[model samples]
Target: MTWADSLRTAWAGMWSSKLRALLTMLGVIIGVAAVITLVAIGNGASQAVASRIETLGTNVLFVTPGPGTPFTTRQVAYIRDNTPVARVVVPLLNSGGQLSVGTSTLPAPVVGTTPGYQALGAIHLAAGRFLAPADITFNRDAVVLGANVSQALFGAGNPVGAHVSLLGQRFTVVGVLQPVGQGPGVSQDNSVFIPLPVAQFLLSTQNLSAVLVGASSPTAASQAQDLLTNLYTNRFGSASSVTVASEDQVLATLSATRATFTNLLAGTALISLVVGGIGIMNIMLVSVTERTREIGVRRAVGAVPEDVVLQFLLEAMVMSLTGGALGVGVGLVLVHLAPLILKTPAVFTPSAVVLAFVFSTLVGLVFGMYPAVKASHLHPIDALRHSG
Candidate 1:
């Protein structure tokens, strides 16, 4: 049969058994709707998590005791002890350092941190382990190598046990952190870490150039920020140069925008999927009843009942396959447009789109089969005698 003839025959049959077609289509409608909704939501949420990982700073907070102008007015007490919102109070000092091994020496930025810095920033250890309390207690001259530092000084060789002199003091290579993949192009891997006390003595700078504070939750970040502001105002008047940051500030800025776009994606997916399923089901059932007389004619012409069944089954499958192909194109377009609409990354993997396409076809075939079989199994005389 020509393609147009097949489609016309299918459409005519579907029109003949409207209610049966509608009922059969229920499964497809629900299945497609669910697939679209669930998949969009799952993908969107996954992308959000990935973005959060990329932008999330290593031990992010604020630079308390600011360098330029009056950065903050919050007091150390509010950040350290009084506020329930703040989780970790990391006081850091930046200073010049020299990584000298054998005859080669390289300049690196030094960061002084409390123990919480490693965990809060999600630092990964490539070799050796992060500094323990013992290192801090004895003021051990141990160092951790950032990925860049390892590459620069030791090349391909392991630098875990190598000794590097920072400034004028020697620090043993206690650990080397795995690379964070140059994310955001931050030179965190090239930096050196030392205990706060050692950094203080070595850098010859006191009173914490910056303080990094963690929050109890995203919500508490702002409250902590505000409280710190007030405390700093009281302690140092307007002259205190401390910055208070809560993760909540970043989230608050993002939630409204993110939610609206996500909902739009989900809604569009649901609407299209349901519509497509209904269309397939309606077309299938109508095609089946309309072709009943043709089935009787075939049986009378010596075609077996099973042959009739297979013929109708093949027609239903054809319709499903066609609809599935169309749905695939539409779904992909939506997935790609998501990034432009949401202003975030719309990661479209071939696997996910293929899964959705296969799912749509299955939805059509399963839902269309009952009506097709009903038409094929009809008694020849009864089908031929029936009115359209």
Candidate 2:
């Protein structure tokens, strides 16, 4: 028989037993769909993390006080004065605090920072202006509202000049920050920013929470990190007194972690496909047994053993491929709806779709082989004499 004839025979055989064929394909359908959904979510999460990191810019480094010492605003000044590689150093302090306008009070993160923080942190002004140099130097009670904070305090009205009660003192709103939604490692939408000295007075703590340092360029970030590390070690008498990490270092760590997580998820999902393959093998073996007389008649009418093998193999492939197509359709729909349902990003990758389909076809080929070989090796007279 020609290839087309063999394919036609296979289709006829499967179509004649539609319910059984559909049942046999169920395993492949579920396995492929599961793999696609898991892989898409994994890729989406990794992309989201990478995008959030990119927004922080390339030349930035985050410094936090470590064991054996405490970090303060004076350390920021020292870095600015001594380190030429570090172009800008912005000291930061933050705490969970309450902001009240009128009788309404809401919990928000209060950030104490300098004017250089606006640029170093990639914060933009939606109205009025960011904290000025004068505000820091004169230790003014000026505050900037993040996007969420502004909306909560003033509704649609301009927030620039509005006063909010914080730390038991009234602070004038100098600016409203543009909206930056939830990010991978930071959330600034509901924060309140004040001058470093103002925070020191109100919170009564001189210790800084973190220091943000911006190198002149990406090439200088490593040198700046090393310089700041050495300075902190010399002053505090130990290398563990300060922790410094550039954006590249942080991104590398995040990427490695994300990749490992994705691989684990995809690998686990693949187990279903293996189980599905075994199911297909079991069903095909049963099919060979039931079709014994049919095969005998075909062989008696000049059909070769190769023809029988080809027919059975084609039937298995057709079932798996059909299931794969159905699974792709289902997976794409789920991936599109995942962001709305799960409230997380879901990225559809064509490569993943193609890989899933190919894997399904391979499963069919491997599992169908044993049954096809068994059917082909049967003696014609023996098969014809078997009970129908």
Candidate 3:
């Protein structure tokens, strides 16, 4: 028989038991859909984290003191004055406190930093201005509200010039920052900013939490890291006194970690495909037993063993391919809706779609082989005598 004739025969045989055919295809359908959905979610999470890292700028370096002692303003000043490669060095002191504006009260992180922090290009003001040099020098009771904090406390109205209480200390709102979203080390939208001196007095700590250093370029950032590392090592008389890392280094580590997790998730999803293939094998074996008499009649009517194998194999492939197509549709729909459900973006990858479809087709071929061979090997007289 021609390929077209064989395909027609196979199609007819599958339709003869429509419900059984559908049931056989169900496993493959679920497997493909699961693979696509899981991969999309994994890719989306990776992209989200990468974007957050990128927002911190590739030319910035983060410096933190080690376990023995915390950083001081004098050390921060020394670095700023001596490091030529560093464009801006900002000392930061972080604390958590409850903020109250009238009846509205919310708990959020409060960051204390100098005016040089603005030079990092991470902060953008929506209204008024960032902390000034005078604010830090005089320990002014002024604060800048983050986007979310502003929205929660003042709603649509202007927050600048409004007075708010932080940790029970009253302060005037000097500015409101634009929405900056979450990034590595800080959630810019959820925190408040104050002068370093004010934060030190309020929090009762003269030691710094961290220092942000901006460089002219990525090359400069590397040089600055080396310089800061040496400076801290010598000052504390130990190499382990401080930790310095460039943005690129941090991004690489985070991206690698994310990729590993994504791969693990994809591997877990692949097991479903294997299970589906086994299910196909089981059903095909049963099909060969039930169609033994039919196979005998076909072989008696000039059909060779090869023709019988081809027919059975084609039927299995058709079911799998059709199921894969339907699975792709279901996966696409779920991928689009994933953002609403997961509260994060879901990226549909073309490679994932192709991989799933191809894997399903391979499953059909591999699983169908044993059953097809069994059906073809039967003797005509014996098959005819066997009960249906």
Compare the candidates by TM-score and give the number of the best one: 2
TM-score between model 2 and native:
0.64
Estimate the TM-score of every prediction. Answer: 0.46, 0.64, 0.63
* Candidates 1 and 2 compared by TM-score, better number: 2
lDDT string, candidate 3, 1-388, tens digits: 9999999988897889999888888888888888888888888777644542346577888787877676788868788887998898888887667899878888676888889878889879999999998998788999998899999999999989999999778999999999987654345677888999989888888898778899999889989999988888888888878878876776777678877877777777678877878887898889899999999998889899999999999888888888788888888988888977765567788998899899989988998888888899999999888886
Per-residue lDDT of candidate 1, residues 61-102 (tens digit): 664564554322133454677777677766666554567888
lDDT of each: 0.62, 0.83, 0.83
| Per-residue lDDT of model 2, residues 1-388, tens digit only | 9999999998998899999888888888877887888888997777654542445577899787875467777888777887788878888886656799998887676888889987776788899999999998999999998898898879879978888999898899999989877666334666788998999889898898778889878778988888888877787888777878887776787778887977787777677777878888898899999999989999999999999999998888888888888888888888888877886667777877887799889988998888998999999999999897
Q: Order the candidates by lDDT, highest first.
A: 3, 2, 1
lDDT of 3 at 235: 82
Q: How much is the lDDT of residue 274 in candidate 2?
A: 73
lDDT of 2 at 273: 75
TM-score leaderboard ranking: 2, 3, 1
Indicate the worst ten consecutive residues by lDDT in candidate 2: 47-56
For model 2, the superposed segments whose C-alpha errors exceed 4 Å read 55-57, 63-117, 121-211, 215-244
